[model samples]
Target: MFEQFTQDARQTVVLAQSAARRLGHHYIGTEHLLLGLLSQPHTLAARLLVVRGLDLAYAETTVLRLLGTPGLDARDADALGTIGIDLSAIKEKVEATFGRGALDRDPAHTRAGRFAGGGHIPFTKRAKKVLELSLREALRLKHKHIADGHLLLGLLREGEGLAAKVLAEAGIDFAQLRADLDRDIPAVPA
Candidate 1:
């Protein structure tokens, strides 16, 4: 399936892995893929996303805010907040005492999924589905290869991943974004 990916599409996948690592996440999810798309500022996906206020920095912050650092979850914070416990403040003090990344869970201690070896983070099922949908999107559009735009289309179509959540948070209209992409996708075959 990757054989049909254009260089830009391949780069997006690589960037997704980088995003996951940078976020201290053990698995590559749709949120990381969305950050990957935004990282490539020159790509059609990035351009469109930026126009809608979903730049890489904003996306990265949103992903971290929602997903939290490794070993932590945003929901945990919310739960703590309800109980008058400030997780963020506690984390800050803990990290200050033990150095940064002290709260991060060791990979070996976490559930082992499909590790790609050499510290390669595995993709979440939904992320893999996004890639598959990218192929389907290319075929649907009568294109020969998958491109970054197709990846974005796939993310939007998936609609249940964290990437979609970020889009929703930004108030981006899925149908309008897809229509805009469809209007512009033909100009670039890759």
Candidate 2:
């Protein structure tokens, strides 16, 4: 199935893995795949998302907040605030003590190094489903290869992944995006 993916699609998957690692996640999820799509600025999917104000950083922060990453969520901030603890101050102190982005770094992965010796970060079930659905979207569109747009279509069609949730929270109209994507997909000559 991956063999039918275009270079951009394959790169999206690779970038998804990187997103997972960067977020200190043990597995690649639909949210990571969404970040992957946003990372490729020139892709049709990225362009559409950016037009909707869904940039990579915002998506990444949303993913982390939704997944309940340590010290990254608003709820965590509120809780700390109640206790008279400033999360931002803590973050600043940590960064001052340990260099920038100390909180973002995964110590285990950092010791082993990026993309190295981390064993392998497997995809979550929903993420695998999105990939499968990407193929289905390509077939539905009568395309020979799955591209990044197809991947985004799959995320939309899945409708319940974290990516979908982020899109919803970002006020994206899924139906409209789906229509635009269906129209924008590059056609192959018969």
Candidate 3:
């Protein structure tokens, strides 16, 4: 799936991962992807988003505010466990720095994303779905490969995700955004 992504698009994903890591998030989410798109000034997606008044700082502020202070949720802990990570050690480390009961007091707030950096961060379910839908959008448009614009389309189509909500709150209409893209950005044939 990654092989078909354009160079800029691929870079956007890396930027997304970095954004998630920088935010201390243990999982990559659509909000991270939004940051990724906004990070690259040269991509069509970035241009489009910026034209609509979206930028990295605004996106970061909105996403962080929306997500709230998250701790390790059960599903995320289970996911980590499946990958052979010992949650107890992680909790101990967190507690050592932030003091006791830090990891458990709000254990259900997995979105807190404080365990980022070092080692691989996994994609959240919605993040994976966004990537899949990005590819699908590219294919549906008969494009040879997925690009940042396709990623924007995927975020729009996945309307229930945080990124979509943020976009909506920022006054972006997905349908019009798609229409504008179709009008301005030509999809290259395979």
Candidate 4:
């Protein structure tokens, strides 16, 4: 929901959409969101992810490998589709977590026209759903800042989503990751 998102959250969504388009992906997978988080120049999400040792470049490489496309250049958008990523699987996970109703009511659509500076990349249904779930979770926790951790948690709750599966394939256990987050997240300043 773009309306409910703080500026940072909105930026993350925009970044995710851009990453999806740049990668020529029909659906915006969690990996795209991860890329989005990393793309931000300076944000808490970016910092936290780096501090936690999640290497964006390495992860991107792994993602490309998982897609069956290795050593593809970033400029080769044409080569992206051949990677064979499971879009349906990622979409199914997003839908299962946010539900169809909430997703359909995504506020990003209302604010679509607002983003005009760097070009507008439309969000796919799955991306919108993932953003919605992430925003809602942030709101639920009374968090004023929507960081990468929130996005990661949203993916985890998606219950074996593409991002979660990717993390697993990388030997990063979700349970352990969550445990680390729990142990590491500093209390929000009052």
CA-only RMSD, every prediction: 4.3, 3.6, 9.7, 12.0
Clashing pairs in 2: none
The candidate with the higher lDDT, 1 or 2, is 2
For TM-score, candidate 1 versus 4, the one ahead is 1
What's the lDDT of the predicted structure labeled candidate 4?
A: 0.58
lDDT of 3 by residue, 1-190 (tens): 9999888888888998888766656678999998999999887888888889888889999987787646656688788999999776887798688654454333334445344334566788998899999988887888888888888888888888889988988899788899876665557622
Cα error, residue 51 of model 1, in Å, equals: 0.4
Clash count for each candidate, listed in order shown: 0, 0, 5, 1
**Candidate 1: which pairs clash?**
none
* RMSD to native, candidate 3: 9.7
Models 1 onward score TM values of 0.80, 0.80, 0.74, 0.58
- Computed on alpha carbons, the lDDT of every model, listed in order, comes to 0.83, 0.87, 0.79, 0.58
* Pairs in clash, predicted candidate 4: 67-83
Which runs in model 1 stand beyond 4 Å of their true positions? 69-102, 107-117, 187-190
Per-residue alpha-carbon lDDT of candidate 2 for residues 132-156, written as tens digits (9 for 90 to 100): 9999999999899999999999999
Clashing pairs in 3: 24-113, 70-109, 70-112, 71-109, 71-110
Q: Mind sharing the TM-score for model 2?
A: 0.80
TM-score comparison, 2 vs 3, better candidate:
2
User: C-alpha displacement of 56 in model 4, angstroms?
Assistant: 1.7
Residues 70-98 of candidate 4: C-alpha lDDT, one tens digit per residue: 33344454454458655445445865775
TM-score of 1: 0.80
